[model samples]
Target chain A: MARQESLNVSSSPARRRGGRKPTISREQILRAAEKFAPEELSIPALAGSLGVTHAGIYHYFSSRAELVAAIAAHASRQLEPPPPGPWEDWLVEVAFVLRGHFSQFASTADLAAIGTSVTFAPLVEALLRVMRDAGFTIRQAGDASELIASCALGGAVVLQRPNFDAAALVEDLQVAEDSPVHELAASAVDDDADAAFRRRLAVVVAGLKASLEAPTAS
Target chain B: MARQESLNVSSSPARRRGGRKPTISREQILRAAEKFAPEELSIPALAGSLGVTHAGIYHYFSSRAELVAAIAAHASRQLEPPPPGPWEDWLVEVAFVLRGHFSQFASTADLAAIGTSVTFAPLVEALLRVMRDAGFTIRQAGDASELIASCALGGAVVLQRPNFDAAALVEDLQVAEDSPVHELAASAVDDDADAAFRRRLAVVVAGLKASLEAPTAS
Candidate 1:
């Protein structure tokens, strides 16, 4: 073959793409896992769909467990960064970001069922910097971080389950008939979800701020 | 043998006296579920193990879904009530209560996952009442309740995963030259699951509180 012909064969677009290009990435593998979850899926099955060798995929992620860890890391990074400035108002924004992120990747909610304890380090690190500078003591800051991440992740799982839309769940909050307060309580549950989440966040901040400013009576 | 005699013989205390009762209450069924979970378990299997007929199990639960829902509700109610006072302190207590509840029935973590959303209405209502009484607007009370509940439930799940142990996780907070801020910034991959979780939680809560109190500066 002519030099040009050999060059074309060796440096074909497909060959140059990689040693063996697969139509898949770590993200695609995770997406498939999420889509077919609660159903055991094998690397061969994933590779078959991507038209790539199983070994090629394994090159990126050493094993199934590593792939899952990557997916979790993706989720942590996907979350909207916590808003800057004051603690209260931006918390509401963070809630929206969290909710949106969880909703967009419904399957990540399942991973959360297992917990983010095994994945998601960088996100945690970023959050620690934010909290420590905000004046939380080491232990207090630690407790708070655990509390919020758990709520966000677990809440996503809770919200995404069959027959449990976020709005409908909140609507279940009607006040009792015998209570002295009726109209206002009923109205409270009726507020839009965004409004309701922000309102609730504000109360938590108020409580935290109040406690922080004054040493806890406890 | 006469029918009456046979019935009496079957009902005799000796048949049931040495071990768990021959008849299963909802609680017994749920306990069995906890023992059998993350494994393939069904109403019939549970009944067979308890030495009862499937019909008897049906008489109590009517359906497997009902049984699972009841199991979750029972676990959720077992959570200790938050102590009277500030949101931050009470939230920490709430986290501990949920953690305790999950630890006691780790197998049912997936089953009890439902209660984190649907069956939590009563708990959320109580929280809303507390927030309102603390001088938050109805909206603010609702917002705070949602955020706190989500965090507590999510945190509990993280603590209950197969690889996580709360005591060990908490112990990872000791600072070292290689990891100066281990208090709440350790990577989740460490064998020290407790410390990693504590670190992540601290940051999330601090961010959450910070988000709440401040409006985003223009």
Candidate 2:
């Protein structure tokens, strides 16, 4: 009676995990994935750490790629689109929102960098609606939203590494201190990626506005 | 004579790989990595596939991440700076050069997305030299180059996945047909990520130009 009651009380959907372990939910896999560095994600290794057979974990994900993608999708639930406002502000907020969410799941951004884009759909509807009101045609809105996300994402990827500083790169390459490359690095604030990203967004927004105002410029 | 020549023929630097296999060089790891899907990269698995132990593979690369980074760095050798010309053209060419190189090695892009910025420095000096001649302050030139790289990188990441189509995403989310997002999706031509990326670069460039032309507009 006690064993029967325990099984019933567990209430996991797929309790028969090849009879290896009683329950290993999708949530459990995602939880574990959150703790892993981007490079550390291997399905068999993930399964081993979870005390489940590799095949058992496959019940939830078709492949390791699918499994890794699901972790980002799961995290996307927490990201809410900001309320509608000025077009530039809206886009900047969206960029920041992306930075906030993906910062925790660097692998998702890494996956994007590699060739698998992790689409976070929660913000799209709101983003599209705002861009539409800002005088962009539907395609423009969609493309613009994608552009902001990409910049935000790319910026996240580039800034995620502390070693990616301009000064460090110039020095490592043996660039002369008096050269133009070194001069560019000289005036740069080494640790201010956030500020640099903000400036980047401003430039992106200005370019979009120019395109909108003078349609023939592009 | 053949046996004596065989050892000499194998001129790879690290000929001592724990006797796991007579020879496994850094070049071998890079060659293998080019064929691997990003999700399929595991140090132990890579070692096993190469008939080497994980430790033996580590003799060439200190870590899997380092191995991955080196693959990109190796490929960067082929990317040369374009001859100096119009600043805009130079920047665009640089962006294209990056796309050309990274597109073949998607994992490098993925690593940048994940938080490990892969620095490809060959073209930076020339890029800075051009930007400086175009009247940008040293910091401005550095920041602008980084911005272009980010947009190009972000665009690469977003477009790499065939499944990341706007129409498909909208359809999957059950967005209403008349809605702005759906309309954006409607105007979208799937499988034209390259065209979209090109347009995105144009906009980013325009924005940078606007910033220079009207300094306080931002």
Candidate 3:
């Protein structure tokens, strides 16, 4: 795909004026942008890092938002389509893959916010397929897919944060010392975030399954 | 609580050196900090906005991190504790309250990532209480509370983004034009984010109930 994109850029009429056809391609720019994302993903910033003019970068991506969308698309390509299986199993895999993909970049949630659904087409398709296979009507599948996808994306955002020291903060506040809340916070001090993610995914999957089995509301 | 905090500040050794006892209190500082949070929530920013020296703000919040925690705590206080009820009903209310609270602030996810667990203590207690009352063992209650909380926080983050015009973006990409994914994206153009949240919450609640009934794993 990168090679195809590079070829398309090289063949385009917008090639820079007589400068030996700029070496960078859109894929290359997106690669560089991903490396600096969430902090320095702007076009000018990317250009500065690549030793290219800002306009030179624009030849490949028409605007900064386009560039961001491309990077998000690039990152999302990491998610493999789900193999044939029950919808719950498929969703579990999808959640894990998404959590892993988005956790790598600080800007994952931000980029996702701006990214068009095209970037997430494969994952969305897989989710919808599973929901349908699970016997949900098209409307139910659509709503379930959105809900599940949102939960996964949201979970990734929370898990990607630096481990929050609930214990230290509780001590600082000097309140809720003996409360169940304190115990929960204290336990998180040694929490494995990935394991917690899997458990939450299970909850979401379980919920969807139960909802499916329940009689439809009149 | 605000009155007590004021008394503590006025009587402290760090009290402003005999000039007017510095009128602002910690609660006042926290309120101001939250008002500008997620963008201008830093110590220097808060100080500048309050027309006070940086050191003056420190007298209230020992560091920038503390100020962030205080602000998260302040925002969380908006969550009224759920009235006594069935555990599932209680959790549903918790999810809605949290989703509502975080959605109102643009920088909610960012602030939440940095805010300490103490900031979420009250909400956590409420969730744990409900889970326990629902007959989940202590460990189960802890895990379920975390799962439910993550889902709520994550849902809020995803829903808070300006709607991605999925249909428009798909048109721009010009691929998957006739795909189920495309239909899904098109439908999102008019999605009611709140209704979707309720549906997802139902899934999580159902999942938790199922897990509780399942035999304990050895």
User: Which of the CAPRI classes, incorrect, acceptable, medium or high, describes model 2?
Assistant: acceptable
Worst 10 residues of 1 chain A by lDDT: A7-16
Listed per candidate, the RMSD to the true structure in angstroms reads 12.1, 7.3, 7.6
- Candidate 2 runs further than 4 Å off: A1-52, A107-109, A113-120, A163-168, A176-178, A215-218, B1-53, B107-109, B113-120, B163-168, B176-178, B215-218
The sequence of per-residue lDDT tens digits that candidate 2 reaches over residues B1-218 is: 55433432332234333444436655677788767775577788888788877776776665555566666666665568988789987888888777665555454334453223335366766777787788776666766777766666666565467665666666776766667755655566553777777777888888879878885532
DockQ of 3: 0.27
Q: Residue A109, candidate 1: how far off, in angstroms?
A: 5.1
* Pairs with steric clashes in candidate 2: A109-B113, A110-B113, A110-B114, A113-B109, A113-B110, A114-B110
Among all candidates shown, the one with the greatest TM-score: 2
User: Model 3 captures what fraction of native contacts?
Assistant: 0.36
TM-score of each: 0.53, 0.76, 0.72
Candidate 2 chain A: worst-modelled 10 consecutive residues by lDDT = A109-118
Best by DockQ: 2
Which candidate, 2 or 3, would have the higher TM-score against the true structure?
A: 2
So what's the TM-score on candidate 3? 0.72
lDDT of 3 by residue, A1-218 (tens): 66545644645445334444446777788778888846457877887788766665877787665576566667675567767787877877776766565555424233233223224466767677677767876557775665555555555556645655567556655665557767666667776776767776776777777878779831
Better of 1 and 2 by lDDT: 2
